[model samples]
Target: MLLKYKYKLKPHKSQSVIISNWLEIARKQYNYRLAERLNWFEATRTPVNACPLNVSVVPVEGIYQNIPEFR
Candidate 1:
């Protein structure tokens, strides 16, 4: 058997302000990372379901391959 306890936080005015600022910073970072991922996918033309580091098939010289089909 196990028990879990949960509590809500009630911060002071200054603490709330600090928390709000941190939340804003976190949101900005999240958006930046999402945009970076989108840009990488667009540039590489890779599917979101495929792993970026998997390069099983080596391309021949002077030959360009499209994004490999992934299951």
Candidate 2:
């Protein structure tokens, strides 16, 4: 047998707004990186319709054609 618990939060308006902004920033960041990686793959004929769940999503060739050393 197993048990699980769920919790709900009722943050204040200001806090909720802050949280929403942070989430939006994170989502945008993720999409930006995803696009960068997908576009970098030139050799693969397979299309990237969505983010791959496979561990081998990035080939041995690697993603990011011009990843900045500082970034």
Candidate 3:
């Protein structure tokens, strides 16, 4: 016979706050990467190759400064 178990997490106040912050950061990164892929596709009309993500033609001065450098 086989048995399965499931558990639910109940975080405290501080832990919940930390989790929220981490989730927010992850959401921002996801959006930024998605935009990068779309922009690349629009400009080249081709799929991305083995090129590094840091080789973006877009500027990072104003709006994208918060994104961590992958290089």
Candidate maximizing TM-score: 1
For candidate 3, lDDT tens digit of each residue in 1-71? 99999999899999999999999999999999999989887875534565556555666686678878897
lDDT of 2 at 4: 96
Q: In order, what lDDT does every prediction score?
A: 0.81, 0.78, 0.83
lDDT of 1 by residue, 1-71 (tens): 89999999999999999999999999999999999989876766767798767553445642556556579
Q: How accurate is candidate 1 locally (lDDT)?
A: 0.81
Reference-based TM-score of each model: 0.63, 0.57, 0.58
Question: Clashes in model 2: which pairs?
Answer: none
Which run of 10 residues does model 3 get worst, by summed lDDT?
A: 45-54
lDDT by residue (1-71, candidate 2, tens digit) is 89999999999999999999999999999999998877766534355686544547557656766676763
Choose 1 or 3, whichever is better by TM-score. Answer: 1
TM-score for predicted model 3 compared with the true structure: 0.58
Question: On a 0 to 100 scale, what is the lDDT of residue 5 in model 1?
Answer: 97
What is the overall TM-score of model 1 with all chains considered together? 0.63
Which parts of model 2 have CA positions greater than 4 angstroms off? 43-71
Q: Check candidate 1 and list the clashing pairs.
A: none
